[model samples]
Target chain A: MKHTLSVLVENKPGVLTRVASLFARRGFNIDSLAVGTTEDPTISRMTIVVSADETALEQITKQLYKLINVLKVQDLDPEEMIDRELVLYKVSAAPERRHEIIEIANVFRAKIVDVGRASLTIEATGTGDKLAAMEDLLRAYGIKELARTGKIALARGSRDA
Target chain B: MKMTGAQAMVRLLQKEGVEVVFGYPGGVVLPLFDALYEAEGIRVILTRHEQGATHAADAYARVTGKPGVVIVTSGPGAANTVTGIANAYMDSVPIVVITGQVATHVLGTDAFQETDITGITIPITKHNYLVDDPADIPSIMAEAFHIASTGRPGPVLIDLPVDVSRGEIDFTYPERVNLPGYKPTVKGHAKQVHQAAALIAKARKPLLYVGGGVLSSNGAKELKELAELMQLPVVTTLMGKGAFPEDHHLFVGMPGMHGGKFTNYAITETDLLLGVGVRFDDRVTGKLATFASKAKVVHVDVDPAEIGKNRPVDVPIVGDARAVISAITAELRKMNAEPRTDAWMHVIDDWRARYPFHYHTSETAIMPQYVVERVRELTKGRPTVFTTEVGQNQMWACQYLRITEPRTWVSSGGLGTMGFGLPAAIGAQLGRPDHLVIDIAGDGSIQMNSQELATAAINKLPVKVVILNNGYLGMVRQWQELFYEHRYSSSTLPQDCPDFVKLAEAYGCFGIRATTPAELDDALVAAFAYDGPAIVDVRVEREENVFPMVAPGGSIDEMLGGIPGGPVSEMLDEELFEEVWE
Candidate 1:
């Protein structure tokens, strides 16, 4: 199972290296991670996803907590949280297919961020599964390139996690 | 009001209650060493090698329950300390290692003597720091000590670049560390304590599985109280040997591989296992699936990660061993819980009498067990600290030497480093100068850091090294003998291996040799009476094997080469015992 942990850490130098190196040392790598400042300027929140068994993840989380700069570790359930990933896909398109791609993008409430002679870049933000479905549907049009800002999530409530 | 980073670090260390520093000087750390020359408070011991300094510091921490420190330069100097760092990390010893780095500008350009030490040590250390500025020194130092000594104690490294050392700052030692992520739980939850007590109260054959954590937390008093209160049998892991008094009625010998037969049997039959400050190490829990198969385990450790690491627990409590065990004791007392233990006690007593640690005497060669037995006999009842190098000698020391005090028996428990004993003995002596300090070493492991004998001589430590000379890597040889048909490849050492007495003389310490049991006793008496460091080498039987052995992957009960009735192959229990008894 992949566990999504929202880790809040002090905004100190080398803390990211410290956190990343911990997972690396344990021979486990994060699946998807996104780091940004939280409401407090001095604290940074990292949303990290790692696929591991309960034992390995618990051990890794314990290791992460050993870091001097790390503040709190809250494991979030995907079903209870509102998760989103912003992805930009460059799709190869002919003049006729370009309009079709734009029509599909409109249905998904996405935007054609860039249009080139042979390709159109579409940007969309949605849940991880939704983005995967969008990528699958657009694959028939010959996707040229893709980039994802991993995943960022917040609880489905005003309560602090 | 103003000082360089090096001076600031020295002052900060003093402020943190650090009294001694261990290091070997090199080119990069000259500035730090120079700063130490000006600082009047701290005492530094210059070891022959960086690794020895680390081990000495580790042993210092092990005995004092304070973080030991090491100062070594960059590159190979830092590399040499890796084994020691890993040893400390594995055993959960608190140590802070300071290494000098190349100038910041020259860090990645393959500068002279520059190594990515922090990168190399990432996996081995609990946490590490790369100092960026002079001002960060106070906070970094504070955090390093805090993180090292707190929670489950582990080694922390600090890499100081040359430029950072020379950088100036106004020294203000941080009053308190600001580490939010590292708050270790010191008190067990109230409900959990009650649940554990209820389980203890109901258990008919409950056992207290103690480990080094009890000793580290100074929980021996509470542990003794709990065992007596509940009338539970106790078996300590190798690291936990001194954590419980071996002389107590409830005390069974060490459990698992190379442990006494009765201890393993007792563990095999327990209904409820109360583990305190212990990880179920393979050596202590032969085959995990079969280990305490019938028991409901209640594990309490200061480190949350260690709670269910090896074996899952029925009740996992994360808190200091001293605090948690004390709390549990308090709960049991409040409830006035009494566990029925007559049947369990009878079985344990029967097994102890049937299979005590045994070896037949020839009067021709000194048995290793006898060497340890004599040490115990001679040093009996006095405040003695026994340290050892790993391998067969370590197991013999563990089996034969009886301990009543925590922090009295220190060894390379996890890493099993060969050279640990000598330097650690020095550190133990340094830590507890008024007590008698002895290192029971093997002929092979002693040579690994025989250089540390110089450290003892120079400091007038008056430590004793009792080398149980079997002329082979006895443990490996024993395995080869039983498992690999005795094809001793690189296991045997030439009998002429640097005559220990001459080597000790070379290092300016008194050296003695014994070939028989009587001679061994005489030599021990002389060594103890000597005013300075001494090494007593005893030529023990060459082919002796540690018995009550659990072949790899075998359950603890499937032991070999000990007193009969075990469900395994036997070599010499009946014959050897008859040979001596007749």
Candidate 2:
């Protein structure tokens, strides 16, 4: 099972290395990680996605807490959290199929961020499943290049993570 | 007052109440050494190698219940301390290591004697720092010591760049550290303690599975009180050897691999296992699924991460060992809990009597177990600290040496580092000058750090080193004999291994060799009376294996090679016993 963990840590040099090294040492592979400063400039929030069972997840959470720079850890529930990932797709488009790709992009509320003579770059931000679905539809147009921002998450409503 | 970072570090050490430091000086650390020279109230013992210094510092911490301090130069000096730092990390010994580094400008350029020590020690340290500014020295030093000595108590390192150490700053040591993420839980949750107490009161066969945390937290008194109040049988891990009185009636011997058959059986059959300050390590819980399967576990540890880590728990309390045990005792008393393990004790006593730790006594050859037994007999009722190098010598010491008090049994329990004993003995002796300190070492292990004899001899530490010379890495050889068709391979040492007696004499230390059982007693007595560092090389049976063995990954109940003519012999399949015996 994949768990999206929201970890708050001190904004100090080598803090990211410490957190990453811990996950590596414990043999837990991070599926995706996005780090940025929080509202408090002195602290940073890291959204980490990892696949682990209940026992292993508990162990990972507890071990993360042991790091001296880590302040908080929360396993954000999929049902109670909002998750988003931004993806860009550079699709091969012929003169006849360029309109088809644009129409498909419009249906998913994606934007044609860049257009070259032979390709159309579509930018889309949504839940992982939604983005995957949109990418499947765009595959027929021939995806020349694709890049994903990975998943970043926040708890729903007024709750803090 | 404004001072150089090197001087500020010495001031911080004084503020931390540190009196002694073990270190090896080099070019990068010359500035720090100069500051140490002028520093009052702190004495620095220059060790031969950085590794030995780290080990000595580790042992000093274990003996004195204070965080040991170490300072050394960069690069090779810093790299040399990795093994000792890792050993301390595994065993949770508190120590602060300071390494001199190249100037900040040349840190990543691979300047002479430059190394990223802070980067190297990340996983092995509880916390570490690379000081880029001298102004951060006071807070970083305070945090380093605080983190190293509190909670689980592990090693911490601080890499000081040459320029940073030379930089001037006004040094005012912080009175208290303000680490938001490092607040260790010291008191157990009331409800969890109540739940644990309820389970304890209801348990018919409760067992106290103690570990090193008991000693680290100074909870031996509370542990004793809890056991006596509930009449619980206490079985300690190897690291927990001295945490409970070995002579106490309720004290079962060390459990798990090489533990007494009765003790393992008690662990196997117990209804409730109150794991106090113990992480259910793999060595202790052979085949985790079958380990204490019948028991409801109530694990109390200072580190919350340890609870339900290797084993599921019915109740988990996160708190300091001493505080939690005391709380549990008080809660049990309030509930009027009484002794209910009479039948369990009867069964345990029967097994203990039937399957006592045994080895064949010989007339000509000196049995290694016999040597350890004699050491125990001679040191009985005396304040003695016993340290052991890894391999068979360590297991023998664990089996035979009876430690009646905390801080007396110092060995590398977690890491099982080979060359820990001799240096550790030096530190132990230095920490507790009134006690008789001895290192029970193996021929192979002693040779790894034999150079430490120079440090011991020069310091006149009077640490006795007893080499159980079997001409092989005995533990690995035992595995080969049991499971690897006796191929022996590279395990055996050459017939002409360095003469340990002569080696000791070369270091200006007293040396004695006891070849037979008759000469063992005199050799030990003479070595103990030598007044300075001494080494006794005792040649023992080459093939003797530490028995009552649970084959790796096998359930602890399925033991092999217990006492001859004992119940285990009959309990085990005839063919398997014959195979082991043969």
Candidate 3:
């Protein structure tokens, strides 16, 4: 099962490597990892999407806690948390296909970030499923290139993640 | 006071209550060494190699329950200590390693003697630091010691650039470290403690499975109290040796691949396994599904990850071993729990007598077991510390050498590194100057770190090296014999193996060689009597194998050898024998 973990760590040198290396060494694959400074400048929050079972997830959390810079780890529940991923797609849109690509982008609430003679770059932010659906439709217009910012999540309501 | 980083490091060591440091000097460490030379109340023992220094520091930590300190130059010097660092990492020994790197300006340029030591040691160390400034020295040093010696104690490394070491800074050592992520749980959960106590009080066939954590927490006294209060049978893992007195009535023996047959059988039959400070390692748990299959496991460990790691734990108590064991004892006392394991003890005693550790006697060649037994006899009732090199010699010592107190038995238990014994004994002797330190070594393993004999001799440590000269890597040879159609391969030593006696003499130490049983006692006595380091090489049977063996992946109850009357396969009925092979 895929688990999105919110890990808070000391904003210090090599903290990222300490965490990434731990996951690598323990054979836990990180599906997606996004790091950013939290409200507190001295602490950073990392939203890590990893695929592991209950036992392995427990192990991952425990191992993460063992790192000196790691402050907290929370296995976010899929139902009780909100997740978003940003993706930009540069599609090979000729003059004739530009209208169709723009129409599809409108339904997904995606923005046309860049336009060139032969391409239209569309940017979208949503849950993983929503982005995948938008990407699927854009592929019909022949995607020239694509970039994705891995998923970031926060707990529902006022509870801290 | 303002001082150079190297001088501040020396002051930090002194402030940390470090009396001795095991290290090897190299190009980049010159500044640090110079500062150390002038440091008062701290003695630096230079080792022949960085690896030897690390192992010696590791053993010193094991014996003294204090973090061992090591300093070495970068690149090759740091690389050489990898094995020793990994060994300590595996066994959870506390040691702080300092590696001198190139100047900060040339750190990543591959300058002379530069290495990414912190990167290399990340997975092996509990934590590591690569200092960017000299001002961080005091706090980093304090944190390094704190992290190394706390919780699940393990090795920590600090990669210090020479320029940083030479940089001047104000030294104000912190009285306490502020590591929010590293606060180890010291007390077990109240509900979990109650649950564990209830289970223990009701268990009819309870067994206490102890490991290195007990000794690491200084919980041997607490462990003994729990076992005696509950009248539980005790089985110590290789790393847990001396956590409970081997002479105690409740003591079964060491349990694992090379452990006693009865201890393994008891593990198989127990109803409740209250594992204290032990991770159910693969060596201890053969075929995880069947290991302690009949038992309800209650595991207590300082590291929460260890609980239910290898096996499913019934009641997990995450706390220090000393705290948890005492809590369980206290809880049991509150309930007026009575000893319910009399029947269990009877069965254990029966199996112990029926399947004793045995070897065939030969007048022509002395048995390795006999040598260990003699050493044990000679060192009886004395403050003795026994360290062993890896392979057959280690297994033999584990089987025969009875350790009555904690910290007396030190070996490379987890990594099973060869060449650990000699330097470890040297470190052990220095740590406990009044104790008799002995290294039970193999011919193959002794030569790996034999250069350390010079260090031992120079220090005049009364350490003894008892080499079981079998002329082969006996463990591998035994494996090839049993599992690979008797092809010797490359396991045998060269025909012109070094004369260990002559090597000892050249190192300015006493040397003795004994080829027969009659000569074993005399050699051991003389080596023990020597005021300086001594090596006693005893030629043992070349083809001998350590028995009571659990074939890799085999169930613990079904052993290959060590049956009292005869081989277990032949003795059992045809149907049962088929199961044994299976």
Candidate 4:
């Protein structure tokens, strides 16, 4: 089981290394981690999707809290969170499939952001499963270009992220 | 006071609280050496070999929990430190290796003795730098120290072009490092802590598979409390030998290859493996797929790369070991403690009685096991520290001695490097002069850097060296004997033994020889009774082999006693006696 956690930490040199090192020493595998500053200027929020079961996630969160610089760690799950992923996908669509591609995009609520005759760019936002399903449906159509905003998340309740 | 870059370097070291540095002098490093002369608080030790200097620095780091600093010249001088840097990298020792390069003008031109040292050392170091500007020296040096000492500590190289070292610049060290990509995660997740607490609350057969990280994090107390609260038996990796008191009932001793049979059994049978500060290295987890086959592993470490490097983890706590363990213990405290059933304990006792750690009795000569046992007896439950070099001697120490405290046994765990014992012993002796410090070394291993005897003598360090002389690379020879039809190639020691007594005397240290058990005991008594450094060379039978031995990649069940299959004479029909004695 993989858990994605958003952590707010002090922007300091060696802090990322310290975080990575903690995972390495503890023998935890971080699947894909995206670190960037949030709305708070002084604090940097890191989105780390770690591949570990529930017990390990708990321990990882507790350890993160112990760091002097880390301010908070939040686990964004489907039940209590609304997750959005922005994907810029370029698909190689033949001139003959242009009408078919537009019809498919309309069904998934995807917008045609770019058009280059042979290539078409689609912008989509949804849950990870939905995005993955869309990709699977479009595989036969061919995807020549693809980019994603690795799952930016927010809690559903009024609690600040 | 404002100073030149060279002076600033020395001033920065002084301010950083570095008391000692080990290095050799050469063309490019002369400026730094000259500045070191005027630098009052910091002292420097000139090593015969650059390799020795780096090893000394590495040993210093291991002992003090601080970054060891080594300074050297350009090109070959910088290249000579490759092995030492690799050694430190392998073992994760905190060391800062500073080397002089050709002047900036001649850097790319391949001047007299210039090399792209930063590039060369990048893969082997935690980080590296090439100082383009002189003013950045103080901050760079401070950052180097910080990087080398924090997180998953390892060697960091700083290749200074001669011009940069000699350039004039103001001196002011940075109070904090601002590395954007170098942030380290230190705390556990609150939800993760709660889940871990829940796991512990429900676990019937819980075991703490502790490793070197426990000692690195100084989290021994937290680990012990968690284990005790959950009533989980603790087994340690080689580097984590003393994280918990070996005398405790919950302690199952060191696990994996060469580990106590009971420890392996405990690991095999556990339902939950709460591994704290361990990487599940190959040596500890013999077969990755079969390791803890029935257990759900909870790995907690500070290094990201080590996670999932071996066994798959059920709970992967990617954070500092100390922080995670402390939180788990705190969370565990709130849960109602459930009493453990004696059924599993009974099975462990049965395994203990069946396959205890016992050696064959040989009346023909002095056994290395006995020697190790004697050392433990001599030290008792005090602050004694034991550092060992590679090969048979290290194995003997691991098997025979009982470490009741953390940070008492420091050796080259990851690298398994020879010549590590002597310098590490010197560093440990210096770090804790009041404690009895000993380095058990093989004849072949000690010779790799025996010149360190002078280091001991010059410093007047009371480090007792117990050299087990078998006249060959014993471990390799044993492998050859077992698997390669006894085709002994370069394993034999050439010619005759050097007069070690004379060698010690030349270095201004006392030396003693022992061939028999009584003689060995007497030599140890004298070495311990003395107030200064001493070397006791114990001559043992050349054919002695460490047993019960497991062939490479072989399971413990296939162990060969002194003789194959049939138990050795002393161990025969002495099950209860074996447990008591071992």
Candidate 2 lDDT over residue span B192-249, tens digit each: 9999999999887789999999999999988998998888999999989889999988
TM-score, cand. 4 vs. native: 0.76
Better of 1 and 4 by TM-score: 1
Per-residue lDDT for B276-354 in model 1, tens only? 9888998888889999998999999998878888898999998999999889989988998875787668767877898
TM-score, per-candidate, Cα-based: 0.94, 0.97, 0.97, 0.76
What candidate 1 gets wrong by more than 4 Å, as runs, is A27-29, A158-161, B567-582
B248-273 per-residue lDDT for model 4 (tens digits): 87887787666766666577667788
Per-candidate Cα lDDT values, in order, are 0.88, 0.92, 0.91, 0.78
lDDT score for residue A7 of model 4: 84
Angstrom error at residue B204, model 2:
1.4
Candidate 1, which CAPRI tier? Answer: medium
How would the docking of model 2 be graded? Answer: high
Candidates, ranked, DockQ: 2, 3, 1, 4
lDDT of 4 by residue, A37-154 (tens): 8787877878887888776886687666544456778887757777677888899888999888888788889999989979889999887888898898788899997998776666
DockQ for each model: 0.64, 0.92, 0.90, 0.05
**Window of ten residues with lowest summed lDDT in model 3 chain B:** B565-574
List runs of model 3 lying over 4 Å from the truth. Answer: A158-161, B564-582
